[model samples]
Target: MNKKLLLICALISIAAAVGYYFSKGPERISVTQYKVAQGEVKASIANTRVGTVKACRRAYLAPAIGGNVAQLYVKEGDKVKSQQLLLKVWNDDLTAQLILHKAQIKANQATAKQFCEIAAGTERDSQRLSRLKKYDRIISEEQLDRAATKARADRAQCQAAQVAIEIARAKLEIVNTDIERTLVRAPFDGTVAEINAELGEYVTPSPPGIPTLPPIDLLDISCLYVSAPIDEVDAPQVKVGMSACVSLDAFAKKRCSGTVSRIAPYVLEKEKQARTVEVEVKLSDAKDLQELLPGYSADIEVLLASKEKALRVPTEAVLENNQVLLITADGVLEQRQFKPGLANWNFIEVLSGLKEGDALVLSVGREGVEPGAYVRVEE
Candidate 1:
């Protein structure tokens, strides 16, 4: 009886050991996977905002006449109108020279009048000579010749005086123009985008290259635009007149509305040695914020394509190259792959990798996640 009892105890111990071994089986990672089905993927590219705010305006605000910067009335942000005085260059020298020209013009006018009077007197005398010759009176032929010579000299003098007066007048006009140009004025009602010359700074018209005298760059921000680059593949999809929205880092919370103003008929040579096409978006005035200065950069959302009830999925749901890991009913992870389609900011259109009611990991960051892992599904 004792031997039989000992054998029974040993059998019980072996059974318990076997149960424990099965419970502690080989380690397996727990993860969630989705069955291959449909989903969505949004495609976008980062781009900078750029556009010409105004056309045919002065970018380099250079004067036709050069002079020292006497007064810089406007800085970078001052508002100005057409013909408004924006700055003033030194005009003392120009002013003094103009005064001299005015005097010269006056003297020339007087000289012209004097010659005219003398010519009039000579004409009267000539008339007398003609009457005397006609009547064959006691008028000497030598006296008639003297009158003719005097009249001829007087007429020539008058003509010369008139020419001199005109020259002086022209000189005065030129000097006055130079002095007026000294007061640089705004060509349009726009903000002073820049100020190249400082107070007491010497400015010149001729640029000598390198250290060359600079012209102030002013921007007319009455109308702003977003200049974005579409990828070569998507370039065909963009067209002029398409509506778009612009966002920027300067004003992240604000979104500006715009339309595709122009699409270049030709592709520009890649700047920075990369291939790119410049697309222009003209923003509506309603979207203009104080921050939207000329050359202000932004990200543009163009309506390339859209759908009402399109198939889509979270970007996290898809894996490499149409491949996804699907968890079967038995909680076993299975590999799946499929084609993809259009994607927005959050969701992507899965052409095939998933199905409805499928459980897929929301992120690749899931712990213990990989193919063949055992996963327990949760919300």
Candidate 2:
């Protein structure tokens, strides 16, 4: 009986030892670790926006007067200079009228000359008759009066003919102006973007109720800009002349430098959405702008602040209340509070309680990882 009792006591002791070992838990937990490094850190506001490449000058060219398109001097993609003739409407009728009026002016001028000659002869006759009547009374008073009256009438006819010449000239000028209206000219140096009307197509004036196609679309692409919308929260920090980096999805690797040109004074609101402000960015380098075209989907990063050679860590490494789980040299976790300065989405600048080459605990939510917990760094 004593031997059996001693065997039971030994078995209980062995079971208790096993329970105590299991209560101690696993020796170490696998955790991801990050090394603190000195690098460049930037605080920026980034947003993806659909942007349109706009020219400094754009126009839809149309004629003031409606007529059949007589001639087209340019097509789409043609470069043009200011005042260059682009299109001409039919001006046959105006040309004919101008010619007729010019002929009338010449004819009227000849009639005026003939009337002036007649008036001069009559005036000479009137003067001689007055002198003869005064010297010898050979001419009757009635005859002298009749000569004077005929001279005056001839002079009036000459004046009327001269006025008629002026009227004809004025009519010719009006027709010439109408003919000029039939021709369309470029207002500025630009490229022809679209040609809505072809030669011989009738173009009507853009009236209130009538829809008419523009004869040509002109765009001056020498200077380009982008119109992008920014969130209202970040709009205050953005100001004119702020440097920005722009990238297009079409050119994935290429980036263009730009400056903030304009910021809207009012916020733009969408249906059940956050308010945004429109901003305009002007491309700075002309060389970099050569390959960029209008209407590209672009994303921009507006640099707000930056620090060079800043001691930084992955932003995820920092936990709530500005505390970071730092790993000691002995592979133990220590929750340490840090003062962070300039930070971005990827990195946070550690202002205090961290050093370059220090190992930082990155995985925060893993089980059995707490203060004073032993951790094994994952390779």
Candidate 3:
């Protein structure tokens, strides 16, 4: 019985030695590890939301007067300069009114001339009054009185004809003005966005019921904007004149540069997250830019900030409550808790609980491993 007990003890000692050899004894990770270094780490919040690229100022071009669209000189995507003729209206009525007013003015001028001629002759005779010059001894007082009365009536008739001419001219001017307005011109330099009317199409005015006229819309794409409604929680960090980078799904490979131009004063409710405030971003290169539509699907990233030098560690290495397993000088694994700062998916800033020259673990799967646990460093 004594010899059997001795053999069993020897077997137990050999098994214990084998187990210790495999576990590598004193505390060390079975995987390769990197030394904690003091370096910079960035705290970034990325949003996977989409937005649109729009113009800073858009326009809706419409005709001043309503009429049948007699002709359209421009179409969609046509570039136009300020005061350039855009479309025309049927101006027959307005033209006719101008002609009639001109005729009336001519007639009134002729009548006024006739009355002036008659009045002049009478005034000349009155002025030459050699017989009436003999005080109280006129050759024919009745004749003199008739001459004076006729001259006065002629002068009055001439004045009335002059007034009639003025009225007719004013009427003609009004109609002429309307006729000139029939040719619609671009109020500014822009591109014709939509042709709401075609040739001979009876397009009505916006005021409604006035009459049918040329209809169209124009917009200026010289400068564009991307209005983003950033959440109120993130808005306070956003400021005017901050730089931004933008990408579009349509132009997936292209990148657009811009800056924050404005921010809304008040917050508004949004369904996806919480209340948000509107932000306007001004594109840097909008002049002569092509392929960017007024409303295009976009992905925007605003650079809030960056850190050049920060202490960083792999996020996977951190355990619960920001605890870290650090290898000690005595080759034992020690439990450590650190204060965490800004972090991304793979890395976090080590605010505390770690020092330079300390080794870090790749993962926290040390279930059987505890504080002061024996371990071996993997090659």
TM-score against native, each model: 0.74, 0.77, 0.69
lDDT of 2 by residue, 1-379 (tens): 9999999999999999999989976598899999999999998776635666678788888888998999999989999999999999999988999889988998999999999999999999999999998788678999999999999999999999999998998889899889889998999999999999977899866888876678888998888887878888888999888888787778766454788888888988873577888888888887768887766677777778899999999988888878888888888899888889988888999899888888888888899888899999999
lDDT scores of the candidates, listed in order:
0.70, 0.86, 0.74
- Ordered list by TM-score, greatest first: 2, 1, 3
Model 1 has an lDDT value of 0.70
The total of clashing pairs for model 1 equals 21
Tens digits of per-residue lDDT, candidate 1, 294-326, equal 655567777665555556666677667756666
User: For model 3, which pairs clash?
Assistant: 26-375, 27-375, 28-375, 39-310, 40-309, 40-310, 67-212, 67-213
Q: Count the backbone clashes (under 3 Å) in each candidate.
A: 21, 0, 8
Q: What lDDT is reached at residue 140 by model 1?
A: 84
Find the candidate with the highest lDDT and give its number.
2
